[model samples]
Target: MTEQSEMYVLAIDQGTTSTRAVVVDHDGRIIATGQKEHEQIFPRSGWVEHDAKEIWKNTRTVVGKALVDAEINRHQLAAVGITNQRETAVVWDKSTGEPVYNAIVWQDTRTQKICDELAGEDGPDKYKDRAGLPLATYFAGPKVKWILDNVDGAREKAEAGELLMGTIDTWLLWNLTGGTDGGVHITDVTNASRTLLMNIDTLDWNEDIASDMGIPMSMLPEIRSSSEVYGKGRKRGLLIDTPIAGALGDQHAAMLGQACFEVGMGKNTYGTGNFLLVNTGDKPVHSDNGLLTTVAYKLGDAAPAYALEGSVAVTGSLVQWVRDNLGLITDAPQIEDLATQVDNSGGLFIVPAFSGLFAPHWRSDARGAMVGMTRFHNKSHIARAVLEATAFQSQEVVEAIEADAESVGVELTELKVDGGMVMNETLMQFQADILGVPVVRPEVIETTALGAAYAAGLAVGFWDGIEDIGRNWSEDKRWEPQMDEETRERYLRLWKKAVERTLDWMDDDVEELFR
Candidate 1:
């Protein structure tokens, strides 16, 4: 066994594109990491899925690789933390640990019709007061309902108390603790807040909402706080008997990893999608705007910290589209270089509503559109348009946040950022320019995993408390606004016009084409 001073915590970051394991020491530095991408399954145009079992297998593989890379064994590990893609749901047999259907990704829009039917005459925000979320396809509750209604025998099995449904965090935690052998089935408040089933105020499942969605309460996991000893690793796994102490949705974990402890402190994570979250202290701040009120994190039995979140469905993934689908760049990093080739988008705007727009405009009928394109524009100019789209979308979300926070007297001065896309200098500078605020990056940009490790460390006495974790955060770089206000406003005006072209695109004719 290692001494307390030398012990390390491991974080399993099960993301949308990949599963990663990071080993972090007491100083909040990433000592070692292991990552592997999983296959993305698209059965139809609007549906996205992942193999739940493959994600579990990759989780174990990455953990083993990270431990070996760190030159440590299970005994040297203080605790295990898990942070994962929120709203990606899985339904599995409790006894067999096999998924009933493919894990429906958060990006999937198969449940739009379900959400519409549920909204009925009250519209999308019908249950917003109790749920703090509009009925949408981006959440997990409808996804669970989809599985039950479509999958053969899933409803029967669920009603009989044999099926289990959870986000990726719950799926990974259940298996990490012990699969098919007394595995603890649980999820943290952060993940539960995105499910549309858990009441944001009570932090418990709303039987009315679940019943409305035609979901069985028996399939839901026990909702727990973000930090605490959930269970121990299974005897068969590499982390045998180690305390599994922390679980958070990837965005909430990023907020914690950034050490945003004070009210009004916020962070933006640029990943497959971009999520901006601002801490609202102990009480939930209802948003009249498009923002969603969610539980930021709950530590042990402490009151849960709430947040107003603006979720954009496409950001970094747009870069992937440019690279893979458009063939504009051979790799993701090349996008920055390509974008810099042109002074601007050369009068081109790409509204990447590939899976419909999220955030301030929850237009499920919207589709991807590339407007303001001239014959003079080239691929390099297109690259600039792609990167600019991300910044514009983020700016809209920030404006909505500002509008909502006016009542509470909370203001966001700077945005702490993390995730793979932060490395793009072009995007970061533009993000700051558009928002007219400083965008700061931390020394450790892998805050998602680090946040999970912090929770685990605090829970198991590996670290003293939030203050100890806060001391480890240090700024690495900052980008200040450079574009003139006049020019920025002009560009934003054009971007909004481009966005308008995407709305109401999925009419009956469009839906019939997919069918």
Candidate 2:
């Protein structure tokens, strides 16, 4: 046996915009990392796609690069865990292992019409009780249906059991486990819950939902616990022979990575989208608020735990738009300095409903808007408003969470945050000020990858238990509320007004553009 100190866990974080591989040691510290960005395909105004082949190739390259950077080989690795952007759907040939169409991203709103059709007279809330998610284009089921209905011969292939379907995690897993040779097609409870086909209580695919969607059950992956030895890496590049031990949707993994084991403890992850999830213990708490109830994580043979998640469709991606589309900034990080140049936004407010508002307001008709822009406002002011937009959106979700938690007799006092955008101290302070709660950041901001590694480590005995992983968490910084209550209220009022303007932008004309 390799010495405990010598063994490491490799976590693959397949996200919406990029694929990252991180190698973590026994102490839950990242030893080395490698990342690759993939193209974001937009077939039309509201449609999004990704080349599954590119993502898989990038995953292998990043994993090999990360291992080489860490000066480690397959022998020193205890296991591999996967954390991915939840709800991105992929359908592929079972025998050949080739994707039938481009992967439909979670942010793609191409299925709004399909979701509307599913809602029917009963409305979007019809599926809320059964699936713990409202009928929105921001899920996997409708995306899967879109592929089957639109892609020629896909429905026939799926019904004939010649094809397999899964989210990004399952796609990576199948390829890593030897694709055509003997790939295991499975997804964790966390990812399955986002599909809108899985029953929250049973933790299995709901036959009624599947039948209603006209989806063949044969195409769905086998549901599994989050932490267990799913299979061994077979033909995967440098990962061959390593145990594939853990699987989690990215947000669930972040919650675990933050050590939010107890109920009411939560963490907010800022990636392509922003998600705030609070551990709701073992039993699922159906939300009266717009937040979606989901599986936090399920270990081997244990009952599944639940979480209430407030998902924002856009946050960090808004920054990317400013850098890419607008060209106001040369790089994403440059926005921080530019925004800092101005003490305030100069009456500008950016409502980034790029993919529609998620959580609290699941309005698919909404569109991005910039209101209250004055002629005197400069690019710095626009940048400030752009950064402030994330904080303001987070405040909306936090308020909704507080309302829901209070209804259930749980009071959330603070927030634990992680993700790439958390590195911006200015935004962190603004978030704290807006929420009027202390925002705490961990010593390691790569919690998404670390969370996956921790799960794999536990399954393979690299770490004894959750307590060992908890001890690895240490606070690096804390931001307290500084703005006066009056000022905060004034800013929030303006934000609400701006959000109202973004709504109903997806009218007949816009809908026609999508088709």
Candidate 3:
């Protein structure tokens, strides 16, 4: 047996664009990491899919690569934590270990009609009171419905209790434990809360909601706390027999990794999208604003911590568009350098409603628009606009959070930031300037992976407690607001104008094409 000192925690982060395996030592530092990006399948203009088999294969590969890089075996691993892109639904056969269809990505907007039908009469907020989420295409429930309704034999298989439904976290968890054999099918409170099928208060699947969607109760994974010994790794895997203890949605994992355990503390993770979550403590704080009330995390046998989250659908992905779609920059990081060449966007405002706006304003009818473009505006100006778009979107969510938190007297003094986009100094500075608050970055930017490691380590007693996790957190750098109130207000006004131009752009004709 490996000594306690020699043991480490492993975190598998199955993200929107990639899968990553990270090894964390006792000091909360990442020792080794392996990452691989899977293909983003866009079958139509608004539909997004991922090959679940490919994701699973990548997961295995990364795990082995990380273990080999760290010069460790399965015996040295104390436990395994799984964090994933939340709300991406996968319905697989329980016996075959094969996905029924490609996994529906969270960003996919093909379920708009389903969402509309679900929102009939009562509108999108029909289930918001119970599920803490609007009936939007951004969630898993509608996506699951789309698959069952469209795919041949899917509904029959689901009703026959042969298919199992789960988000990316649940999918990874089942495969990691032992797919088609004895895999423990379960999801944490955080991930479950994102699905419209789960009752937010009870922390369980709402049978009424499932019945409404024509989904079988058997297809749902067992709900579990964020930290617990769910199961062990499969015999054939690199983490064979190691405890698979923790699972969380990527954003919630970032919250835990940022150590925002206290009520009123919050963190904003800039990734494929920007998710800003503010801890609202034990009892759920229902949002009057467009924010979603969600489970932050639930440690083993402990009451769940709740949060108010504002999700922006497009942030870093917009940068990807500028890189891949437009030939503005060769690399993602290079955009920062080009953006710095221009002091501002030169009156250009980009509303990246690429897949529609999320949080504060849930408008699926909206589409991407670049307003205030002039002949004088060059690639540098476009780069600046692209980076500023992320900041502006985040600001909108922060405002919504503040409004929702105000009733409870919870205020956000500062924001703890993380993710791939946080490395861009240009964007970080602009984020602070636009928010009018200091933005702090931690020494570990990949909080999503670290948070999962903390959960797994805690469940297996590799770490003492939440306080132990807190001690490991330290600030790497800080960005203070530099823009004056007058300038900030002016930029905000222009941005709002640009956003308005995007709305209702996907009108009747656009709806016809999708249908």
Clashing pairs in 1: none
Task: Report the error of model 1 at residue 137, Å.
Answer: 0.4
> In model 2, what are the clashing residue pairs, if there are any?
none
lDDT by residue (373-424, candidate 1, tens digit) is: 7789999999999899999999999999999877646787888999999999
Local accuracy by lDDT, each model: 0.93, 0.92, 0.92
What's each prediction's TM-score?
A: 0.99, 0.99, 0.99
**Least accurate 10 contiguous residues by lDDT in model 3:** 403-412
Supply every candidate's count of residue pairs whose N, Cα or C atoms clash at under 3 angstroms.
Answer: 0, 0, 0
> Across residues 306-388, which tens digit of lDDT does each residue of candidate 2 receive?
99999998899999999999999888899999999999998899998988999889999999999987779999999999889
Q: Residue 295 CA error for candidate 2 (Å)? A: 0.3
Best by lDDT: 1
Candidate 2: how many backbone clashes? 0
Candidate 3 local lDDT, 372-419, one digit each (tens):
878999999999998999999999999888777667567878889999
Candidate 3 Cα misplacement greater than 4 A, ranges: 513-515
Candidate 1 residue runs with Cα over 4 Å from true position: none
